[model samples]
Target: MKTSTRLEQAIKKLYVAFHNNTLHPECCKQCAVGNILNNTDSWKHLSDYHGALELNYIGKVNESFGRKFNGYSPSELLKIEATFLKACGYQLPLHYKNSKPKHPTNKDVLFNGLTKVVTFLCELDGVSNVMDYTKLFEFINEKPRFQLDDVITF
Candidate 1:
């Protein structure tokens, strides 16, 4: 399937990070968005607090000017990080007081975070989520129940 250049690049980076054991939920420089941005922690400046869904003043100004970091706007970056963190069992605005998984670096935990981030990225790109497997089961009797194009809407 055709995908935007930026989307493809982001997915590639995530793919490498997931397999290379570089994805760490608590580290801004090693999380999903961080890996997408080439393992940089700069994206954290987009939000006042880590794991926050809202952007800070600087992030708002950048979004106003259509500024994008690695093909993702400041707001989009914030959302991506929040989604990853939440899926990895981290409480919002992550901190010592927030609830988190007993094993943040566990492969299963990281995989869950990666799945959600990829889904969110696909949503932003207006494409089918690459990780979605339900479509494989959405057929019957050696025939398709729906057209492939219909799946893209999801």
Candidate 2:
């Protein structure tokens, strides 16, 4: 299968998990993605950009929760990150010196991509509209407002 196909399928799986309220790793006793999301401390790290989804962040989460590290590889982490962020129509948080992506990133493109994901999520959650769902997530709290014509380099 193509990479895009695989990603789409993964996102669908994620949607199901969310819909079922089984997104927690402990809920199903499953993999790293659920583990990370279910742990509030870990999720905060990702949300706050305290660390990337790398070894250090995992270690910190593990320490915070008193859970032993489960020895997931870097590629595994990247795969998980890609799937989760893509499901939210987001890329990995950029933490480099310039805080820019290697590829061009525009607000319209991101907004559109996010709209697709958010719309699907809304439908799954039985939310009838886009604005309603965004309000629930409070997603724009710290981000720049995305206008239809706004262009961002990252």
Candidate 3:
């Protein structure tokens, strides 16, 4: 599937961050947006609060100036962060004591966050969700590869 060059780059970065255990929802420099921006915390200035979708004064100025970090506008970046936080079970506007996963580096948790971020990015770019595998389930010869309830004998 064809994807924008920038989105492709962003996905690669996020994938690496997830596998390298560098992705963290709490840290601005290691969060989804940060990873997409080359692990820079500067994207935090785009919003007054972490996980917020509203752009602050600085963010508005940057948006007005048509500035993009790794090809994402200020608003897009904010949305991406918000999506990641939500997927990771974070309360909006992240707090030190807020309810979070017991192990942030847990692969399952990170994968959930990555899936959400990738979905949002795909939507933003008007492309199909890269993480979606539903198409792979489409029937061939009017039969699925396997039944959902099928038991495996190993």
Candidate 4:
């Protein structure tokens, strides 16, 4: 398949996972695109439009964060982390305790922080609807390497 088609299929898979309430960490992975065909629950059916929207939104958000701040301050990082969590259809936690600092490099620390944020986002609920893919793409394209394909399927 073409890359565009592959991306579309990936997006569709995400939507299906979302609608079935299977997009959580237990059912899917942090990489939403990879989760599409990762053989999680099972490739039961094509994702509906609603599922696609949710998937696309999450993808856009992830791409946005990756582009905007390759490195970020701790506090700014926390907000970005929160945005990622929300994009994954998760609600922000009532209280967020800071993790201990161990990594020496900014990249290492950012990776560790993102891992925790992704984990927290995966635990959220009540995400069972489609969003506007156009808006998602627009927001994501504000940063580089974050463009949605013109067409999608599967």
Candidate 4: how many backbone clashes? 2
Please list the C-alpha lDDT of all candidates, in the order they appear.
0.88, 0.39, 0.86, 0.34
> Candidate 2: TM-score?
0.26
**What's the C-alpha lDDT at position 101 in model 4?**
31
Give per-residue lDDT, candidate 4, residue 140: 38
lDDT of 4 by residue, 1-154 (tens): 1323333444455456445544433122422322444543221111212122222343445445663222222223334334433443443331224222332123433334334443332322222112324433444335634335432212
TM-score of each: 0.88, 0.26, 0.88, 0.27
Off by over 4 Å in 4: 1-3, 25-34, 37-154
Which of candidates 3 and 4 is the stronger one according to TM-score?
A: 3
**Predicted model with the maximum lDDT:** 1
Q: What does candidate 3's lDDT look like per residue over 1-154, in tens digits?
A: 5689888999999988988889888898999998999988998988889988999999999999999888989999999999998898888888887787788778888899999999999899998787766655767788886554332211
Once fitted onto the true fold, the runs of candidate 2 whose alpha carbons sit more than 4 angstroms away are: 1-16, 21-40, 43-54, 57-75, 94-154
Lowest lDDT block of 10, candidate 3:
145-154
Off by over 4 Å in 3: 140-154
lDDT tens digits by residue: candidate 2, 1-154:
1223323443455455555544432121222244433323333333334224454565555556655323333334334544434533334543445232232233343334334544443444453533342333333778645543232111
